[model samples]
Target: MLRIGSGAGFSGDRLEPAVELAEKGKLDYLVLECLAERTIALAQKRKKSDAAMGYDPLLEKRIRSLLPVLKQNNVRLITNMGAANPLGGAKKIIEIADELGLHVKVAAVTGDDVLPYILKKCDSLEFKPRLSENVSILSANAYMGASTIVPAIETGADVIITGRVADPSLFLAPMIHHFGWSTSDYELMGKGTVIGHLLECGGQLTGGFFADPGKKDVGGLAHLGFPLAEVQPDGSALLTKLPGTGGALTLRTVKEQLLYEVMDPSSYITPDVIADFTTVSLREDGNDRIVVTGGSGKERPSELKVSIGYDAGFLGEGEITYAGENAVGRAELAGAVIQERLQDCYEELTVDYIGITSAHRGSFSYEGIPYEVRLRVAGKTYEREKAKRIGEEVEALYTNGPAGGGGARKYLNEVIGIVSAMVPMDIVEAELQVMEVKPNGA
Candidate 1:
């Protein structure tokens, strides 16, 4: 059985769980699935500023913490933490290895950035009026498949980092490399995809997202363990986590994860194959173990989905807290005062009595007077300066409108909007650059 573990589910996932699995779970491969559409766009923005800053900000910390454990445990690392710059991420890894006086082989997979390709070939693109006429296209990256990573695995790399690869492909590539499964073998590919999908969102398969204090009361949440899969060559696998660790891997946890973000159960599209989740079978095998089998795939898609990010605009926000008697009234007045002040600048502004109606947005009034409340004001505009006015207005509320206003805070950022485009698979290529670091500094 080949053991694979998931270190992270998203860009900001906790790093300690991954270290736990590498040191104690006896995993053969550990995959960190970072990089979402918005995060990548943000990374691209950072890259535009510093060229080398596009990769995951946590890459260095995660690597420094896990490298020794992984090296000692003989566990290989695979991650998409490269974000927009796989090469830069690889360089950082080599530098870390050299600093630690360890021997390591690292591979950086590339060619997923399809911004230039889409611009030159496709015109009236998927997102708007016209690709050239509207929207500043910040990034365009195709979802690469397992085949892209197979070469890196073959190079005996201790750590493999990639950009814009499909989440499932990160896990599937190791299955293909170890089991010698053919990329064209749709049946095995589909089955393996199932394993990858389940473990992609690390803690979700554990108790991180499953815990409901009363309804689904789960144990060991304080230090929730990440997921791992013990696979057979035929693609059947047992999903579980490190023993004595936080969280349970029961049938409920497995089932909840099965349909998470899945639109059509039978036709889940990925870069590698068209998987059908309808045929999947799951059963509880003792405690903290779910045996998963079935779920097959047909041929891969002719076209790949590319996530295109645009400069949506700038968002400005500010908040002030009001507490004690008639706090709700004071907070409401503060919001109203800001609204009237900005009435000429905007037709409508997002002014919320946070504790009163921030979530439901004026739906379901507070039955009883709240002892404390917060007033929040926000607005979005194309111009950055206009956005600043939102926070400026909220700050003035302390002395101008609301009494007992304290702990005021404000924020502003360039909002990123994501849209999808379909590009021919032939247009994008996945390239690999492998490097080595030894104590000798070679």
Candidate 2:
């Protein structure tokens, strides 16, 4: 049996929960999945500015906090913290380990960035025509799977860093290496994939995102613990979190995570296998523990999903609050004022009344007016100055329009748009390199 714990779900996740898992979860491997579609795109922009700055911003902090305990417990670490540069991330980890006087082996799996290859083979590649036209490609990464990661694990690396791979593959790789599961073993691989999916989101399955107040009550969310999976050699798993922790691991929580981000539950495609979530079954084995089984799989997909990012435009946003006596009416008037002012400056504009029609977009009845309402104006433009003007016009509404309007806020940000395309698996290659760190003064 292997005990693998999820240390992080996204890039900005809290570190204390991971520390708790490493210290108390008795984990064989602690995997942190920090990269998201937008996160990697931003990382590519950062790497373009500085050669050594593409990985997760908190990579060093996470390592510095958890390295000692992980080393002491002999639990290996696996992560895709190497957002755009795996080698750079590996060097940073080695440097941190050296400073801590800890001898550690770090392995980095690379070759996921396939931008150059895609550009060269654009005419021959099997993807949409739109993928090649009308946009500057900032980053193009193919989602690698456990096959490339298994070699690093086999080398007994203390820490494994990867650039861009499927999130579940981070957890699945260790299971494959530990159990020697054959790639063609679709049923077992499917089971392992199910375990990976459940544990991949860190606290989502452990009740972090499952709270609904009066409906689905979860306690101690402030100190909510991450999740762990006790996976057997047969690929079946028992999902649970640390005892006395802040979150619950009930069947409802598990089911919610099971369907998260799943477009087609019958065919959840990945680089490794096509897992069928519809065939899966769950049963409560004990308190805060559910037995997972019946995850079957077919052959792996022929093409890998590629995340392509490009600069879309710039977004400008501004908000103002109106309170007391006809607040809704005043807020509506303020929104109209800003829209009228910036009609020609922006390509698109939106006027939302925060309290009345922001969420439903006027779908619900507006019979009862609220005591306070916030007026938000947002616009997008190719020109940065034009985008900034949207917020400037909204901020000017304080002196020129509406009574009792206060708490003005404005911001402008670059928009990085992401699109998904398919690349043949045979064209993209994955490689692993290992680096060993000695004591600091050695």
Candidate 3:
């Protein structure tokens, strides 16, 4: 059985502990996914200016700590934290591994950082904006497949680094090479793809963010444990965790991960899967162990997927607390008062009394009276500098108006507005396809 661990958010520094856990548990593969909407923006900015400087410190630091364990255990990793500088990132990792006298082979799966290329392609393709759309492509990342990483593993690398790839590909890459799973084998591909989906979110199945629906104690979420998947030759996988780990690995957790983002189970497309989610079954086999099997996958669609970000515009928000016998009522009045004062300053303004609302779990539920309330105001302005200046003025209202016993004023910080525009899927498609060439030295 090949043991694997996966996670949602990955930072260079946060990856250190997870690496230790993988080594301590003697797992086969460690996968970290760090790409998010904001991450994409940061990557795009870096790529345009200094391509090499965009390397995330989190990826390098984590790999540095894990290298010794990986060298000892012969563990191979696939991570997408290589935002826009996988090659530069890989070189840094190689330097660290060499200094430690560890013979680590590091290969970077490139060609996925295609923001510049995609924009040029869009100009020639005559792509149009559909929904009052504007092309502010803040970040452009390619959602590649397992083919990119497979070549890296074949280089005998202890760890493989990659740019943005489909989340499931992280789990699928190791399974394909480990079990000699063929690409065209739809039935087995489905099996492998499903396994990746189960373990990709690390602690989701291991009781971190998600827990059993009906069970309260199931959220034993003090120190969230990472998730693991054990794969077999037939593409079936055993979903479990490190020994003595604290979390519930039941059908509920597995089902939650399975049904996640799955609009249609039958048409689930992975490079390996030709079957549907309906073809699979899961059962609680043992303590913190769930066995999953049976799935078929279909061929992937033609258009290569792209994660492109554009300008979203600017926004500003401010908050203040109100405390009194009738805090809820006072808070509402304060919200109205703040809006009235700011109406002449901003073109758009929104105010909400959070304490009495669903926010904070309705904690201040009072019988016709309450202790405290949170007043919040949010809006957008074409001038970000002006918006920030406006956010600074809100706290003054507390001392000037009926702000509930004039509780100490709380001012919100300057808010910077970022506009994210979604380009057409084709707007970010690859122009120069990635061809896997054999390593020069290996």
Highest-scoring model, lDDT: 1
Q: Is candidate 1 or candidate 2 better by TM-score?
A: 2
Give candidate 3 misplaced runs (Cα > 4 Å). 7-17, 47-50, 121-135, 211-214, 269-275, 344-347, 358-370, 404-442
lDDT of 3 at 137: 59
What ordering of candidates by lDDT runs from best to worst? 1, 2, 3
Q: Which scores greater on TM-score, model 1 or model 3?
A: 1
Which has the higher lDDT value, candidate number 1 or candidate number 3? Answer: 1
Worst 10 residues of 1 by lDDT: 124-133
In model 2, the clashing pairs are none
How far is 95's C-alpha from truth in model 1 (Å)?
0.7
Q: Write candidate 1's Cα lDDT for 359-420 as tens digits.
A: 99877884788788888888888889889889988888778876889988888989988778
Model 3 whole-model lDDT (C-alpha atoms): 0.66
Best TM-score goes to which candidate? 2
Q: Which stretch of 10 consecutive residues in model 2 shows the poorest summed lDDT?
A: 125-134
Candidate 1 segments whose C-alpha is farther than 4 A from its true place: 128-132, 362-367
Give the lDDT of residue 422 in candidate 3.
31
My TM-score estimates for the predictions, one after another, are 0.95, 0.97, 0.84
